[model samples]
Target: MIDNSLGEQYLRIYDELNFDNQASRRVGFCTLENYYATVMEHVGTEVLNTGIDIFGENLAEQWTVTKQILETVDREPPSEFEGILQEVKKHRGNLYHNFREDIPQRRLDAIRDVAEEWRAWLIDCAREYWDTFGAYTLEDFDYIANEINDYSQAYMGDIALKLPTIKRELDYAFRTIAKQRHRRLHYLETPDIFLYDLMPNKTSSEISKISTTYGKIGMMASKIKKGEEIDTDEGEDLMYDARNILISICEQEDPFGRTFNNLHSSE
Candidate 1:
């Protein structure tokens, strides 16, 4: 019943995402530009890596990488994904070259929604790819659970030195807050979680934690808006009330939790 935001869970075969698209550290509850960058950074990198793995290092560009992933997986992406990719490119162009300061909130939210859907599809395709080639996917003795094993294993020797740091990073990822599907399931299982509604001050610490988590998410957005890599924590919780609260907001508004993003907006 763990939330998907725990990035370590995906350490076995693929790296789809640790959290849902909107509340993830990648998007950081920020603006559309950050959301767009996050989608491209995660999805684009994965697709590009798949291409370089399957088709070798001559991968052309970001859009080409997405197409290559679709072809490699032998799964046709939905037609809407193509248009979404175009928007992704447009966002990237606007984010980088043109650098506009003015964009409509509705448009940004819409783009965030589109990017989330597109990334979800990409994750599905990646899962299919991993499932398909997982058996014969090793190169000699280079197999590692989640990492690509087709290449050389020269770095394996460093494992002795890096294991502690890796564990620390994972611990951080597990505690960071975000959107997750499992939040609803867990909430449904334990109605007592609603007791906090009856006695709000009883769980003041919990409320503070959620607020802090949300603040971290927003910080991530600001960092991404400035084109910084996602650097933050993934806070763990006993009941995952934080994630559920955000998901609830998304349900009332739209799929990508734009309500929370627009909470501070004048619009």
Candidate 2:
């Protein structure tokens, strides 16, 4: 869990600033300082809790939690992770120590973005660490840890790119469910057509393309289910084409057919 004590402090400062109005410009500054402090504390705590192995003579040195986390995962810290942590720290410093009359919205936005990236990285690192060396030795651990870190980094990067689309797709799904409920109550019949035709048995590349295609289909389905008429002239054609492809693929005999047939016959 996240430590909320500092957040509470920042909230209290904000409340004070709001109450005093003109007299509390200084209070607003103070609130900004408190907020930065809180954010730093939260980030620090998260880094520590990830349970990274920090070995070497400098272990006793006051290394940042982010450094520790990366070190634990790869033995050698990643430059990318280090860079993100530095950016977060820089923003925190600016929010705390910089006594400018007006806080730039851009600075705050940058800080928020950095925080989000930090959180995503930490989560990915935790998963990679756990999955790789939940039970392995130093040599085995090193190899697996490196591989898992590389995989996790790539995976996180890809997921980050798709976050906006993922959110849209999920929102569409919820809306579609609500609409479907309404339709069931009124029409008392479910739609027979599948909005997206996907073949789980297909090759990885095909599956990935279908996943992306179907995600859009899912969003479209949500609109259709809601009784909000969507122009699916293009969507309909794609769906029809996809279904035909899936049907053709499914009808093909299994590659291990003869061996399985003989085994079954023997049994």
Candidate 3:
């Protein structure tokens, strides 16, 4: 039996390793599930008569995108051999004296194996359905691929591109900081001071530059709020500067978080 302290440590390690993976896995599973359902709905009576050959090389080609999406989300499909090995280990553990040496590692390995198998099984079920009912011909594959790609692009792009969505994100950030600082949003008119106060680690010169750019953005946001016209070129420049500021700060604090290195690169 594992001691409480060791078990807790193992749990912490598992949580840390799976933090982003859990979200990615869930998203991947959901995407595959929806894809399967869509294909089945479209195929209808064609499913029973359809064979893998009917898809030609189209389904095989489309699988590239499916695999790409999974990889983008960091989804790792489980290995059947690994699952079998885990089962054998579990049976052995039951039949003989439990291996006490490195028990935490063994326990963690078993949990990871089981978790992987569970996610893989979920994805496999969807893939099986999709493979069976997805496409009747090359044309079908083309249509389905186009539809799925469009949906995926639109869904992901809207998160950061839309003004309302951006405002909501910014508002949430501000409200969170406001609560932390015990300040009200209605009274928080000067973003320059508020931002300066929050970013104490920044040099005064850097804060001054940020304040100046922020003032321009603030004015643009005000015009937007009041349904007034603004210059598109000015708005785009402000957007670039704001993004560059974030990139610069993140690059200093967390090299890994910098998505783009060229601050002056055109959007």
Best by lDDT: 3
Candidate 2 residue 101 C-alpha distance from true site, Å? 6.5
TM-score of candidate 2 relative to the true fold: 0.28
Residues 1-267 of candidate 3: C-alpha lDDT, one tens digit per residue? 111121233334444443244343333322332333233222321222222331333323333334443443354444653453344344434433533322233543544444434433434443344333331223432333443344444333322243333334334544543443334665246756666554445777887787677666666777777777777777666655555444333222111111122322422
Looking at model 1, the pairs that clash are 5-18, 28-217, 175-234, 175-235, 175-236, 176-233, 176-234, 176-235, 177-235
79: Cα error in model 3, Å: 49
**In model 1, which runs have C-alpha deviations exceeding 4 angstroms?**
1-48, 51-60, 99-101, 135-267
Better of 2 and 3 by lDDT: 3
Q: Write the per-residue lDDT of candidate 2 for residues 1-267, one digit (tens) a residue.
A: 333233556555454444333335445544544454444444443333423333321112223654565566684435754554455445445544655544444443443344435444544554454334331223432433343344444432222233333334333432332232221221112211222221224566654554455565556556555655555454544344334333322222211221222323544
Per-residue error for 184 in candidate 1, Å, reads 42
TM-score of each: 0.33, 0.28, 0.29
Number of clashing residue pairs in every model? 9, 1, 0
lDDT of 1 at 176: 19
Residue 214 in model 1: lDDT: 43
Overlapping backbone residue pairs in candidate 1 total 9
- Regions of candidate 2 where Cα sits further than 4 Å from its true position: 1-63, 75-84, 91-102, 133-267
